[model samples]
Target chain A: MSDLVNVSYLAVGPEILLTLGAVLVLMIDVFRQPSARVHAWIVAATILAATVVTWFQWDRVTGEGPFLAFSDMVVIDEYGVIASFILLLVGALGLAVAWGMVERLGRRGAEGIVLVFMAIAGFQFMAVSANLVMMFMGLEIASISLYVLAGITRERPEADEAALKYFLLGSFASAVFIYGVALAFAGTGGVSVYDIGAFLRGSVLLKPGVLLIGMALLITGLAFKLSAAPFHVWAPDTYQGSPAGIVGFMAAGAKVGAFAGLGRIVITAFPLYEAEWAVGLAILATISIATGTLLAIAQSDIRRLLAYSGVAHAGFILTGLTAGEAGMPAVWFYLAVYTVQLIGAFAVVAAVAGPTAAGSPMSDYEGLSRRSPFLAAVLALFMLAMSGVPLTAGFVGKFGAFAVAWRADFEWLVIVALVASVAGFFFYLRVIVLMYMREPAVAEAPGTMRARLEPVGALRWVLIISTAITLAFGIYPTPLLDLLSTALPF
Target chain B: MTELVLFFIFGALALVGGLTVVAARNPVHSAMGLMLTLFSLAVFYVVQAAHFVAAVQVIVYAGAVMTLFLFVIMLIGVDKAENLSETIRLQRPLVVLVGLTVVVVGVFVAVGGRFAWITGVVGAGPEVNGTAEAIGDDLFTTWLLPFEATSLLLIIASAGALALAFFRPRRREGKEEGAP
Candidate 1:
């Protein structure tokens, strides 16, 4: 059947590459002595190669899969292409960090790479999912990997606790999401966002309970992914427990892909039901800003603080989500900016946080400028960007988010954002003050961390590029704005 | 209709399964209850005509995942788990309260939709095929950028996780091994 061939050709390009890479890494891990492993790097390189190949094949109509397989559940598209590339790239970075980290933990093995590829593959499926069935499957694949990943360092009890909590809460959220999908399917005879959008375009509401309940449940599930208020309870614990590198990976890579999906669902498919969902979203946004910022201020632990800070930023992104047509491009640009800034900040933290179990607390940053002014300055720039100060990438992201919102007649949302920005400044500034302005506490632990503070590695260089772009965009944002102009969910 | 009857059966199973997952004293019992819950979920997926998804739900989630949970319980040695938390904590009350609140909120939100702002204005009902062709047409034409960007994002993640998880421990601290 042509169907079989088409499906193979269409889905096989990226899917086969990822699946084979994952399987290959596993097989090789079995034979290679743990002490003499080279397969991890090979796996990383192969993934990049596969992604490049997939990118080149983007000349065709992007969503056109080879055949209608999986019961028409998945489709390849520009969306899928972008998602796949990002997933693979971020996965490689995770591999590199793990390469350094595994030696630190004294656990050299193949399971980590296998799970990473598996998760990347899962995220790829999610990007291409066309129906509720595929979407749920994709989500499960990604989530299962992450659950195991949280506890990969099986030696750490906190890792186990974090994974357990993440697993349970994630499961509950998945159930709610699927239940909502079922109801939505029942109500509209449709499961995909586009299909739902078509059905809702010119109709008056019926069985409103089904739609409203579905939206609420779906939002609850997505809120957990976004790590927004109320549903964000698991983030800090999980982030703290997981390896610092994994924290960076999830915060940047996962957030971008997840938010794209969320934006599509809300702005495109469910816009017709704005009457039911809009107010709730606004309330959530407000709460996220308040709770996340306030909670972050109380955290002495760097990872926990970043986790809460991540929550507040998600609220900022939610504002764009609420802005409808005007919000899409803004949200996209913000996500890209957010991803880079976060990666840079986490890299610095991971590199410089001094010799404590969870690395140095916020207090350890004391006189970081004196120790490594170069590192402190780099981090300070990122923190300031996070604060949305002028001449930085964060400002452009925040400005775009607000501009679109005001254009969409949500001026009050804009005001709240302004206030939150000011409130957020206090915490970021405290980090800076401790680094440059204040003396470290007297009762400090021994073994001062003396790793070279220069941004020497490829990863560090990558962070520098992101920081430079942030500054460049802040000064002349027109190029990015133009690119954003075409990214639409309006 | 068979559809109506099937709904009630699976719904009942799901409800009971949920209750047992929460109330079971043993960790293994809870895991089994969760498995039942997941199975009921697959049944619902099957009822809804998602064959592949149903199979995945049963095999991947219920079988593979539940096995892991049970394994962990065994590894930790179920005896190590307390039948009940002795310390009076806020966890129990909070759990019960949140559980009841979901139900209450569900009921209210469901009923309240009748009074929805666009109740009289929006009127289309579910009848579209939602097949691969339909979704493909829309996605290829409209959702293209997000599609590609998301894949790119995931690829990056894959490399990073692999690098960390499979990373040879000898790169950075070749000297750490020499420590006496």
Candidate 2:
């Protein structure tokens, strides 16, 4: 029993720090002066500590069997470690980037910081979930937090509308997810995955009555999370309505948690139904690739454009899901690439501000090549990386993703991939031409243009780090691949 | 037997209340409909043996989320005239979208999601601790990293929400109201 207690403490120690820190930050902000900006740095430090702790566990880790502690509900494994680490790092980046971005807004409400911590914790819950109940709880935590974040601007009806839509859809999807879990429970008479797995090998549901219905519901829930085609209607509006920094974090960090969590669910629970679900995933991949790229071409709003681009990126990630046994590691590596590149793009976009100036506009980027070549060049690097240009992380990530599809004998998907990649290049390059070739909307005070257009110190560093990592991984992706390969037992 | 009864009752309430929320003419009435739907959902949680979730559903959702909705409705000052949509985009047909989505999800399943391995994961177990304690153990132990890491996301959500609330970037001019 003492041994069990030790194991539990060892695993959850990082979460304890985070939860306590988040609650404390909120309480302190309430009692102390509202203007106290103490929690940003403190939150940053606490997350950093948690990351260090997670890392320490990584080093001292001895392989152990995945267990269902607490009456057999959840499992702990290397996959959880890898996914959680990414979440921590990204969440910390969210705070770090927001430090400047929020200050730029000049409304110092620490509760906003507190809410983000809660959302991150909620997403982490999804990543580690085993039972449907846990999954539902985590989904609510993430979704509700997102709805509030989406509509926080009371004056903007568009923001309000976006929140309402996201909320309504989220609740609807939650219901669908729960109903699926219920159907699964009906088939198995038990709520545990282990019990379900045992029953599925040859159960009454296996005869194709109730069990089949249950599986479809489960996949639907996961699809909404992945933002794969058909279920992806909410992506553009939600991202466009959200604040730029939040959209960026949601794009990268949220996907990392959701995809990893969903991947675990698919692989662990539904391997027997691969033939049935795999085809659906394949169709989603094709449509997601084609539709995501084509629709992005029609967009004028920059945020909306990125949001659509995310849809296409999700398609590429879905290819990993369809690659069957061989593509799992690629899924992991590709997600990491997608996260970094997105953060870099949004960071550069966010950094386009002056002391008293309004938010960044596309027109502000006109002729940026002449004003500050560095910013232009940074944006260019991120765009190029997104386009899967050689020597950038996007290339290797795409290659890794498609290679899995190839291994699955879906070579046509590769052709579709090539077509999508070629098609995607135009939109990404449009940004380049706009910055370098087009002229700024208005001439700036000579040095003012340069100073104003400069990147935030922290965000600039973040972008630089992300850029370096993208390049490094592009040039040498084996390290990431090796890490992902070792992180899961598949 | 009691569990089944509770499930049936909540399921009936949820179905009827959900329908009412969608069909009601008055926005406040719709909000009330939403409340009933939420309450039914709480009862559903109880039937599932998720006592903690049921409590949260009542407190956080039915109590807090519903109250927040009521407050928003009041602040917006909805009346008979305002409840009506002025544009063609928000006509009655939009109601069908929800039913359509459910059907689509159903079709995906009815067709077996077109994969064999996805036949469905079913299990048999000696269930214990229901939902709360089991989840508590699971979350605190093996799943601790992901659970803790979720805080970072909450931080992002909070910052984003706050920025939206305070920044008030003008959609057209990029400046706030009355600001030079």
Candidate 3:
């Protein structure tokens, strides 16, 4: 028993380190009165340390094959390790991209950094949690931090609106999720994911009405977090109004964590009901792809356009999920490559619009190529990658997802996804066209001409790294695909 | 016989309290209605032999939470009555339609096939008692991780409240001149 307890502590070492780092940063800010640069360094170092710990955990788990700790409340497996790595990567790059905003916020920067740490830790917990209630707790931790992060610039009315809307809708979804947990517990007499699966496999339930309803509600709650269509009303407003610098992290992190949780629940706990949930996911995918593509074309703001595009991406990822356990590798691959592109694109937005600014009007991108060729070139690459043009990471991701979904007898979903992918190029290419072909809208007033948008400091590094990864993986995706093939939930 | 009588009385009280919460115009009155409902829920927990849970429901909900709610109401001033007027067009009709749909669904779920709401095997898992000892043992042992993780939630809540409510940025000259 003592050995087990000790092992449990070791298993959760990364999470503990993150939590400690958050508190430590807060304490240092209070006592030392350090600059925002110091806080950023602390956060970066903490993320680096956590990644190292996760790497060690991956080594152990791969050797032993998915170790459960804390009385099976958490499963330390390749799936969780990979998810944690993605989240940590997002956190590091996100902090770098948002560094200017943090410095501008002055004393409030420490709180923002702390919230990021806590949010990342929370999402990591969500990825690893084995109990339904534990997952709920993780979701709340990440969500509350994000809600505050969205409104960190409280003086901006748009920020306030975004925060309030996100809070209200997010709380409603949390309530629905917990209610589903209760109903599932009542229906299965179990709260542990593995135990629920065991119960379903052992006993034939004649009246699965309550359980089915619970499952639907759970899916709905997660879908809202993933920003799938129909539940994606909050995405456009939140993304458009949030400070530009960190929006990438917020969007990418939530998808990674939510998909991890959703994949685990559907594939591990409720695989017996695949036919039922697969159809539900298929419907959500169809709606998301259609709505995201159509609405994205209509958006005048760059941020809102990205939000709608994220919805479409969620549908594409869900297409992979419809293939059940067989498609998890495709889903992970898509998530990794796509998130890098997302962060990279938003980094350009941060440079164009000040990091603390609320909106990124599409007009700002006109004549970007003439101003700063570097920013325009990278942004174009990201846009092309998002559109799934040939020889891009996005193409590989979409292709992988489509192939698996087709084999799973979801050929129709694949067909719809293919159509949506083609339609998606319209909006994505529009940004590139506006950047390169069109002249600056304010060229009439030489005095009002905006300064050259240069990627400097940490933002430059973020762009370079993301661009390298995007292209590298686009050319040769075997290494990542091979790694993800081992990242299966036990 | 006494248990049945107690159940019926509290059940009715809970129903009435829930209705009054929605119906009452005064915010204070609605709070009182919510308290009554909470108290009735505590009674239900006790009736199920979940003594610890009942005690917590009373102390946490009926006692502490009610006091906080009343304090907030007092701070906001009770003279302001809640506006019951509908602002959006067709709002009332849409609400009624949704309410009717929910009622129909509830009825169908209750009366469809099996009358028993809980269809799981009753004694498949460990026998649970309502004692603090049993709950504490499980909480400290099997549920220790989640229990510890709850501290993170509390920290986030408090920190988030602080960051949102306080933490104003100092205005720099020429930068924030045009805003607000």
Candidate 4:
């Protein structure tokens, strides 16, 4: 029992450090009014320290296999560790990419950094927790922080609108999630994922009416978070209206956490009902792909376009899950590559549109190549990768997802995804064309000069790292694939 | 017979309160209706022998949350009536249809003779007494992680409120002066 207790502390070491770092940052900001740069340094140092702790936890999990901690409320496993790594990476990249906006916010910048730290810790808890109530707590913590971050630049009415819509819809989803938890408890008399699974495996229910409804509600709530189409109405408005710099992080971090939670709930806890849920997930994937691709073509704003594309990508990720546990490797790979590409693409948006700007009209990109060759090149690369062009990480991710879904007898979903992928190429390529082929709109107006666009400070590093990852993973994905193959829930 | 009578009375109160919350024109009246529903819920909890939960329902829902709601209403000013015109075509009909579907499904479940839906081994877990001691023991021991995690949620809520509501006076003045 003592050993178990120690392991539990070890399992949560990163979250503890992160929460302390958040409080420390807030305290330091209150006492000493420092530059946003100092807050960034503190946040970076905290993330680095947390990463080291996660490394140790990873070593222990890989050596000793997965173990339950804190009376099975938390699980220390490779799957959770990998998800944590992705979320941490997102936090770091998100902070760096949005550094310009943080600095622009002046004194409120520290609050932004602290919220990022708290949000990362919350999502990390979500990834690791094995109990339903614990997961819900983590979800709310992360969600409320994101809701605040959405409107951190309160000067913009659009930002306030985005925040209000997200808060209202997100709270409703959380309530639904807790309702599902209640129904599941009533049905199975257990709240721990493994315990519920054990109970289901041990008994055969003649009438699974309440349990089925509970599972459906749980999936619906998570589907809303994942922004799988039909539940994806809030994504476009929120992404378009929130400050451009941090939208990447918001989208990427939420997806990673939601997918991690969904994967565990479906693959670990409800595998007994896989036949039912897989079909349901496949139907959702089909609709998401179709809707995202079709609607993206109609969007004039770049942010709204990416938001729609993200919905389609969510569908592709869901397609992999239809293959059950065997498809997790593909899902992880797709998530990692896609999230980096997303951040990199939005980094360019931040550079071009100004970090605190809410909208990025496609017209803003007219002749971007002349304004800034580097930004245009990287953005185009991200676009190509997002559209799943050959020799890009996006292609490999989609291929892997489609392959798994095909093997799972979801061949029709694979087909629909392929057609959507082809259609997706249009909007992505249109961006490339506008950047490269068109003349600057300002150039046409005499006596007007459009300043050269350049990525400065942390945004430069974000682009470089994201681009490198996209290219390297595209050329060789073996290492990531091998690592993810070991990332199975225990 | 007394228990049934109490249940019916509180249930009626809850329904009325719920309808008023949706139908009342005055925001303050809606808040009061919400308080009524919450109080009725506490009564139900007490009737179920969940005295600890009943107290928490009254204290947290009726006392604290209702105060927060009223404060928001006061801050926003309750004089203006909310617009009830439909912004989307057929929204009212769609909502009614959805609500009807939920009611029908709930009724079917309740009267469908499926009360034995729970299939897990009975009494395999900790026993519940609905007392503070039993709840505290479970919360601290078996549910320690979730309980501890709730602290993070509270921290987030407070921090988020501060971040959104607390603006620096200098920036506010600058913005005001800069405005045309």
Best by DockQ: 4
DockQ metric for all predictions = 0.13, 0.19, 0.50, 0.51
Cα misplacement distance, residue A31 of candidate 2 (Å): 4.6
User: How accurate locally is residue B11 in candidate 4, as Cα lDDT from 0 to 100?
Assistant: 96
- Tell me how many residue pairs clash in candidate 4: 0
Q: Clashing pairs in model 3?
A: none
Best TM-score among the predictions, by candidate number: 4
Q: Give one digit per residue, the lDDT tens place, for model 1 in A351-384.
A: 6642113434776678777666777888899899
TM-score of chain A of each: 0.89, 0.92, 0.98, 0.98
Alpha-carbon deviation at B23 in model 1, angstroms:
2.8
Candidate 3 lDDT by residue in tens digits, A1-490: 5444434666787889889888988899889999776787788788888988998998888887888888888999999999999999988898899888888877777777888888898889999988899999889889989999999888788988998988899888889888889878888888889999999998878778788888888999989899998999999999988888879889998999899999999888898999999999999999999999999999999999999999999999999999899999999999999999999999999999988899999999999998889999999999999999877888899999999999999988999999989999999999999999999877644445466668889999999999998898889888988999988888
lDDT of 2 by residue, B1-180 (tens): 997788888889888888888778878888888889999988877676778888888999889988899899888877737534546775557767887987887577558533243334334344545567777886676454445545555565555555455554466463545455
Report RMSD for candidate 2: 5.4
Ordered by TM-score, highest first, the candidates read 4, 3, 2, 1
Deviation (Å) of A442 in candidate 1: 7.0
lDDT, each prediction: 0.69, 0.70, 0.88, 0.89
Model 3 spans with C-alpha error above 4 angstroms = A1-7, A444-449, B1-16, B81-88, B109-116, B123-127, B169-180
Compose the digit string of candidate 4's lDDT tens values, residues A3-39.
Answer: 4443467789889989988888889988998887678
Per-residue lDDT of B1-180 in model 3, one digit per residue for the tens? 877898999999999999999888888899999999999999989887889999999999999999999999999999975677888999989989999997888678767953344766575455559999977877788788889988888778766776777755444443578655
By DockQ thresholds, what CAPRI class is model 1?
Answer: incorrect
